[model samples]
Target chain A: MDMGPHATFIWTAYGLSATVVSALILRAMLDERRQRRALARLEAQGIRRRSDVAQERRG
Target chain B: MLSFATLANPSFFMRLTDRVLPWLAGVWILLLAAGLYMSFFVAPADYQQGETVRIMFIHVPFAWLAMFCYMIIAVSSIGSLIWRHPLADVSAKAAAPIGAAFTLLALVTGSLWGKPMWGAYWVWDARLTSVLVLFFLYLGLIALWESIEDPSRAGRAAAILAIVGVVNIPIIKFSVDWWNTLHQPASVMRAGGPTIHPTILWPLLVMAVAFSLMFLWLHLKAMRAEILRRRVETMMMTRVSSAVALKAAE
Candidate 1:
């Protein structure tokens, strides 16, 4: 059997899929870390509502 | 369970993430690296179908993850509806976009692979049509969640929809068999054995593991982000309310 150039289609598809999924995973990680840190800062400043803060304090 | 609620505490979550995120990031990078190496270089080209079979490494895994993500959202939604777990709602909501993304990837990659192999890009095949419906279901859940102003109400409503939509997952899986369609019937996930050879099977399995790990890492990250966003919104609203009260006093 003569295996020819059309085989490139499968390799290209796999390559593109890997690239896209990797990009998404990286983006989610960065966004989550950034947002978590920011929220931690806000929580630390005693900036929450009285009711919410009281719940936390009581717990 | 209330005692364990501390796990969901924003500060506790932040602390846990400091320890966990790096490991998860490392695993994602390492696994993807290994999976790609094995997929592209280590794995041999298919004998019968030649290189086009290589597309299975990505297309099959994404298809699995898309279904897996939908199951997660449905289960979490049910949990939220029954127990009113705020985190479950956050999980269900956060997973919608990611699930939709995976589903879209599956469709696009399948189409790309299909064109050369099946000689068509689009077909009203059963498996393909049901998968498209699953993608739309994800979008609908996301849109419905965003449409409501009240978070709690929105969560409950979206949860109901998620649970109701779950009946379609099995339909999506069985569609190829239930109807004679252009799409191939289940081979890997059959009762007897996978029809694909061991060489192709190993890479595909490794890729599936890598995809699952990636999904876990991202789903956790997205859930954490949703939680933080809610916390930030609450903090901002509190500050505004206090400023109004102080102005009234003055």
Candidate 2:
């Protein structure tokens, strides 16, 4: 809707909030994806989970 | 066999979160959509403040959640220091940046709201100042975590700082009433009831839920990344150890 005189300030605040929040969310998700990909690469080279070793030792 | 101890293991945690993450993501998306719809269109503008009053939907939620997240950090810090929970440090570390970002949003939006109303971009009022201090506290915590080489030691140091910072939360809460200030006193969270009309109150509450869900989604996702990063670190250390051992044998 038309925000009248203070439209600039209003839009700026909303725009900034959207940009920052979106950036933070994107960073978190992308960082997780990056970490997952790296972990997969390591696993491809036979890097096993510490938990797997622990279970093996217990058994 | 979902034992708590096993769940604390990073691999187990990764599996657990991987299952739930989609749901968390879904909920946040839906909530934010509903919140934006209500906040922008459904909620009527304030009689005096006019269109600018719309800023409340975002600013108030950010301010509330910023404080809430700091408390989360403090509690996680305690969990890290006292119980030495394996995931405690991970939770605290993951929360810091998110808290700091929300606090930054709060300060920025609050200033934007302040300008047309207060006729100034900044004020040294108790509420605003205390919240500013909270932002610094968040930054100091993040810096503390990064500066220390050891995670355990960093968590302990940060925990003590967070505990001490608890004193400031009340000051932020009561600052408008405690002193003569340009900031308005609590209308929504007061003793008797919310002074805000239901038309405005409902959308604000919806926006608050959206912000909270957004925070949880980010925190969980970040926690997953941190766990994976730790796994990589441990793997690297193992590789180095084995390399040194092989050299010794040769």
Candidate 3:
């Protein structure tokens, strides 16, 4: 019960563990989104490079 | 039937992950909130244990998830190594750290629980020793993957190790049961049924589900990042090669 002295230890452990897990999950998701965006940008740049090459060859 | 290659497409997998991650995150948050409230406010504390019994709320669920995470890695590693499933490698890689985290959590919380109940922080009992072995197994797998230069080869090697390590899972689970140990016997998963009261059982189960969902969300995100990292490296290499060719022409 909340009346016991050891209740603090139990609560502290649970709270800290939950916070750590949540932070890790959030950090992973954010990093993934950033990587995805960077890849998309690189893909677009590659497409631009190819189009420029095709135009130069035609000219 | 869909072949492994179809599942291996990075874009296809990304789309699936996008849809799944949000739902998993949302459910995890909701369940965590609800589970905590139930555990702290609703569930009656043990008559004998006072509040020390409350440690079981986190410890038991984490122990379950630690084993569950290993199973995920083992299964994914098999798919990658045997079937050459590309996503499987990334999934197995991402899951290693998360599983290691869970194992660490279980061990630490179990120790904290033991201090008050057992009048000591730890015992070299079979149950405790086997769980410690499980923790080391995760670390070994992580280190093995990191040490190998070739990704595919690493995946195959780790897969073999994981497959062999499957025997340890049962040993960890049944160690307390098989041998007389200071650790209590299985209360949640048993042949007859869970002996714990429903109020306590409900929160524990919810927390377990929340933890599993959180792991899935993170694992998929990590896999996506890993694939993008590979793509970026390939692009950089291509650009470097072209630049070298231009300098040679000059």
Which candidate achieves the best TM-score against the true structure? 2
Each prediction's total of clashing residue pairs, residues at least 3 apart in sequence or on different chains, is 0, 0, 0
Number of the predicted model whose lDDT against the real structure is largest: 2
Q: Sort candidate 3 into its docking category.
A: acceptable
lDDT by residue (tens digit), candidate 2, A1-59? 88878888899999999999999989998998898788788778776766767989999
Error of 1 at B212 (Å): 0.5
Native-referenced DockQ of model 1? 0.57
The share of true interface contacts that also appear in candidate 2 amounts to: 0.69
> Residue by residue across B11-86, what tens digits does model 3's lDDT show?
6787888788788878888988887787788888787777766677788878998899889888998888778877
- DockQ order, best first, reads 2, 1, 3
Model 2 off-target regions past 4 Å?
B1-9
Q: Write the per-residue lDDT of candidate 1 for residues B1-250, one digit (tens) a residue.
A: 4567886565676677768977977886788778777777777777765666767788898999999999999999987998887778889998998899889889988987788878888899889999999999999999989999998988888999999999989999999879999998888999899998787788888888878888887888888788878877788788788889999999
Every candidate's DockQ is 0.57, 0.77, 0.43
Better of 1 and 3 by lDDT: 1
iRMS, candidate 2, in Å: value is 1.0
